[model samples]
Target: MTRWRFAQGVAALAAVLLLVALWAGAPEAPEAPIEALPIADVVSERLTTLGSVVGLAGSGDSHAWLGIPFAAPPAGELRWRPPRRPEPWTDTFDALAYGSPCVQLASGFGGVSDQDPGSFAGDEDCLYLNIWSPRFDAAEVPTGDDRMPVMVWIHGGGNTIGYAGSFYEGSLLATRHRVVVVSVNYRLGALGWLAHPALLAGAEEGEPKSGNFGTLDLIAALGWVGENIEFFGGDPDSVTIFGESAGGKNVLSLLASPMAAGLFHRAIVQSGAVDTVSLASAVNYTDEEPPGDSFSAKEVVLRLLIRDGSASDRASARFFAEGLEDSEIAAYLRRKTAEEILSAYRDEPDSADIRPPRVIRDGVVLPHRRLLDLFAEPGAFRGVPIILGSNRDEIKLFLSQDPAWVSRSLGVVTRVRDGARYNFVSGMHSDLWKVWGVDEPAAALSRSQEAGVYAYRFDWDEEPVRMGTDLGMLLGAAHGLEIPFVFGHFRFGDEATAKLIFDEADEPGRRFISDAMMSYWAEFAYAGTPGRGRSGGLPEWSAWGSDVGQFLVFDTAADGGIRMSTDTLSTQGLLARLEGDTNLDQTEKCELYRDLFEGSADWNQATYSGLGDRGCPPESLNTARSD
Candidate 1:
């Protein structure tokens, strides 16, 4: 290991050794006091938000506190309702290990949630947030000048499943960028976001009666941060919101949500878009079936559950009481298994009334329809600066076929026993469809408020994730690949492409790029622009659409990383097919377009789930070759 890496190892070892005394009420060691090492200092702390917050404060120019619950557990009767303020406690709650992730089916989530095999399990009490704030310099204090910018994070799992523990560590960004960082967890799956007519009718003032309940949880956390971050020495007004994948989508949602206005000043969205759920769907929220012929969130859950096994009151009761343990719940779950319990819920009387009918046009929270449509209409948000990009091989996580089959499968087509034929595939999978909009994020942002937009493409993957094949070979900086580079985490890309994906020339490569990222992010937080007027030796990035075809490629290759095009986005084409003016509604349109999807005779659904045309067609002025 390099000297810095060795230092890291030693620091971690020391941290492990020191954690014993940091535990609340634990005895301090009797060893003689030694001078502080190069490592940062962290301490345990209890903060009061909706409830008593047990948090840890790490030292540096900044400090971080981990795992503070922002909302009440979604247990029992509260399962489908919007999250409430966690019940207050008289004692300090221990914010030690990241709390359990909310209970989710784990069907679609891959990278956004914990990718670790041995740590962090998904649970009911998963509505917590983690905070990282740079130290307040005495100069910035009221009498002392002590203040730094803050950036809060919201993890993404399609408003279903994700946690605050993985894929993000605010230390590097916090101290290096001289800013505060925060990551949070929210409700997910059937428990976190279930919008029903009955629930809507019961909506009280200040509560999100319909549409997005999980979104409300995020708002509450922001509110909590606004109130408490000052205690940790952060500037409350100059906050930025950022995340990757689903978390990016959450940030955008917050931007439009009335409840989230003024909570953040700047934003960074890595691979998130608005065209995810078509505006057409049906539900069984009431006694009878919903009045549409389209597939709805509620209907999808009901059918999936019934198919999964929820067939009667016992099953229904089990599914409803899933993870709801004042006591005995864990035993029941252990006895039945998660699948069996979920199956039982499906078998219930109104399983169809479970989740959101659809992420419909909520004028209050979303403030607009079709994410880009609002940009077209203008005034969708506070018009803050945004740093948005996607990985070159973002589709890597979606590589489903065993690696052994990759080479042969690349250009050839085959028919399976299910009478399904696989075509030459390229891109992500259906599960990705569960969370991300198929539209290229670049295309989506082109039509949005475009002033502060910064875009990038991630194209790196180090090791192959395929259990049976070198699937990574096919994924060139696939989805979310740019994240590590942006955050200065280089392990996310391919060993072959690392230098190309990021500046890998030396320690300065990591430090410089990280510095650039931090400065730009901090600059955005400070003054709606990156770098705080300092270039950080990085190239300038420009906005897209309406001509001026300019972009800053993030690759380290001496290609100047500059490209321009206004014709790569075919969002209109994709939307037209997904939700068109035809008499057919979106689901019907999709059903009709089924011939063009995965198992169809001519198309490759596994990797390339797009219109026959790719992004950025030179022939079209409004599209690009990448689109």
Candidate 2:
């Protein structure tokens, strides 16, 4: 079978087994509306350490400072270097509109744009942040013990796309929780993560030589918060950093980073994993004796050379690139435009699907040790309160779009072809995600740290079935479905898209869950723990213990409400269960095993090969390694 068809079949089979217990039934009736703070005009000006900033009106009783520059533009000579602080302004900076999103291929899912998907948009001068806070007098900046807690958000798009734009507006979160919210923009794609020996030749001796520039940009934003947050009524000492998906991965990178020490007191990682590329893989060519990634820096340069007519073919390009000195190579790469650099890695001219390695293990910005090892090692990571979680049906979001499992009508509405298989496979992948992203880290951190290490599983799946589209089964508590609940903002994409997932019939439950999540998140930011939420009248969220697997289950009253669960998962247990399963044939079982090995950080070749006659071909393993 072709790789694409094999992938679909595996997804279908794997998803069938995991959806037995998680999906909740439809609610009986609409409940009471959730009570919220009154909306009123508030102060919108603040004087930062750099200069004055004038903000604009926001939703409810909140003020929004949009597009406030935290760092100088990382353009031209600054492209791959660490971010620098913006120059002090003489005039009051007009923080009324959002800054341009960092350069990325536009898509329906990430970044801000009206442009068609796969088209290029955004700008390199995108080192800016947006802030939201409850209304207060301009002269009365909260100080000392009275300052509000600060929560900085990092948007997620595989660390390749997304920005601090309208979809992630913090006004509702800020005004509702009576706290300060900040969202930042960072460099992305090849510009943000390329690592090569040539590029490091002229670099400074410290973290600048490390090619984890996107990670550094986040650290720089946190540094800005430390110096200037008090003017916005936010306490720097009580700062919390939170993100979803790629943003969550960035948070994990920060936790593992020695450079980010004491910058933020708490962290929340949602559906994120620990991953980084080796220096050899970052700099080598894919066709070399010891092959590197397809998008390695040397390979990218060769592609650029061919694209620009500097060479006629791959062999000539390789000969030319290798003959050049490190300085010459660096200078040549630095001279290319952002579009030119990005075009070298495009799989399709009209598809934003490039997947280059990110978050390099450069030993300076991010330590050389594995992330889980750092967590287990005392004094390696900041032992602050942290929450790690994943959605119960995370993989459904992606699988629902796959033609092998789901079919769509009118190019919008969708339906699952085989609900049993789809649910089972999605569940397995989602469970594995939880194991990799949430459980493993929580277990490691809880064993080492004195500070609270909490865990959660989002299980709110109450979408109404429109026409024949079973959104409850199709979307469920899928990836990124919890983001709106966390922020209490349900507006995503256009009106029809929003309505398809979030129905008016489920408004009360949606509001209920969103309020609880916000309270728990805000309370965690205020104190070290989320005990009984901010109101001190919800279910007590116990910390993850070293012995038992404990985590709060977030759902509506109809679906068991907010409660605690002790069901923890591990790779060994999952593999054993897969081995014993009678539902899948030998080929299907091997396909699932292949996916598991491919997705895992701790790959055990012996264990995989021990699957006996059910094992995949040895060549498949080699292909996986090369890719």
Candidate 3:
């Protein structure tokens, strides 16, 4: 290990030793005094919206202001409402500590740590944001009008289980790239998206009563940055909004929403598709149906009413709810705690309502239609530079969650049947879902808007998987794998998983990838183009329009690191390839087809419409539904 790494290890070991000694009641050891850290006063000489904030400096001269509240506490009457500005305070708000995460389901991730003394795993009053900056002087008191480009991060946890503190550690990016970094926390799960007629009835005049409170919260945070980021030496006008998965989905919503027109100058959507359900469909959530279709707040409320014995059945609950006066229902809903409301959707993991469609087509925070459809329209979104990307093995994360699904899909009966075919199918699925989801919208943006749209495919597969399991190969640049590399956060998430994903041996490759990725990202945030500003010795990244249909592939290679290539697969293309391979028997082809199409709504739709154009028999494309 390098000297810096060795020192970190020693410090960690010393911390462990200290903890053990304290637990064992051993004699106290002498305290080793350390030098004080550098700090920067983010408060400018001029008056600002946020009174003042001081940022503590880290190893690379990067300064951080943690847990700054961006909005008023969204509790009580504001539980499911749009976020409001925080009341200005006279006292200086200390931002050294992390703010509480919005109320969410328990995740095995480190953010949900009960062990941490002041961890806020499930707190309702959680509309906070954090900032990281590279500008610091000898006194480290943010001494200039030097405005650094800003990158605001929105973390991904299926819109249910992540916080700004969990996934983002921005010092590396800020210092290395000379950019300002901001990460935010918004409401999650039911608390974030709950929409009932009672709540709608209580809405103030001209206020949007859409169930997308989480989205509105993000808009408010962006507005806060626009109004107050100058104090932190940040150029709010050059802000780039980037996020992964659910966060990426939010970025897409922001692009399509009129309210977010002037909030950000650029956007990056990673592994998140532009898909949404209508408010009518989401509020009518149910459990009897399969996934993706049913996501009803009504069902949850029904379950709540039944659990509390307030109603005998769905009928009675409906009668009581529909029959009651708007004020009465509102009063009853407001009485229920966040925990009680979240409990209704916790037990059934397979239920359609589990991840209810938080992105609503409510014509307020979002457009009154599918995001993809909006992108298709000419001049639909703001003409901002955009980067759309997805990992190679995106489906592996979901497959790992259900090993049985993996086994059935891949025909892994004994000794993992046909590994090559399994890999092919997995790749095909990633392309169909993510590439089609991301690339299509990118193409739409390129055709419609003047701003450039860039595409990327994260293909890093060098990390070692857990011993005795094929997760390493299975999770080749899976859904969330690119995030750690992008943020230079190899040691993030839980310790065990962190170790599994980022081994010590892979440090060189990881570091190389991190430098390249951060350079590209920061460059994009700064100059509207990823390859234009301070490239840091990385190769050129061509824009999507220039290349027609190519993507920048991220991986470690001896010849060249990042290469441009086309994501070569489609729903029909894969089936045609499988059919052409006469070496495989009909049974194998059928099984592959079944796996590809079963509960695979898009593929099923294509096959139902007739696969004759793709040289596949309609009867041959059979699908089997598996749990």
Candidates in order have lDDT scores of: 0.48, 0.79, 0.68
Query: Which candidate, 2 or 3, has the higher TM-score?
Result: 2
Give the winner by TM-score: 2
lDDT of 2 by residue, 454-494 (tens): 99999999987765566789878877888888888886643
lDDT of 1 at 580: 29
Question: Candidate 3: which stretches are off by over 4 Å?
Answer: 1-47, 115-121, 135-145, 285-293, 347-353, 405-418, 578-627
Residue 132 error for model 1, in Å?
1.3
On a 0 to 1 TM-score scale, where does candidate 2 land against the true structure?
0.91
Please estimate how well model 1 matches the true structure, expressed as its whole-model Cα lDDT.
0.48
In model 3, pairs of residues that clash are: 284-296, 285-295, 285-296
Error of 3 at 348 (Å): 2.6
The regions of model 1 sitting more than 4 angstroms off are: 1-62, 105-121, 135-145, 204-206, 276-358, 400-451, 461-472, 490-515, 531-535, 558-567, 571-627
TM-score, ranked from best to worst:
2, 3, 1
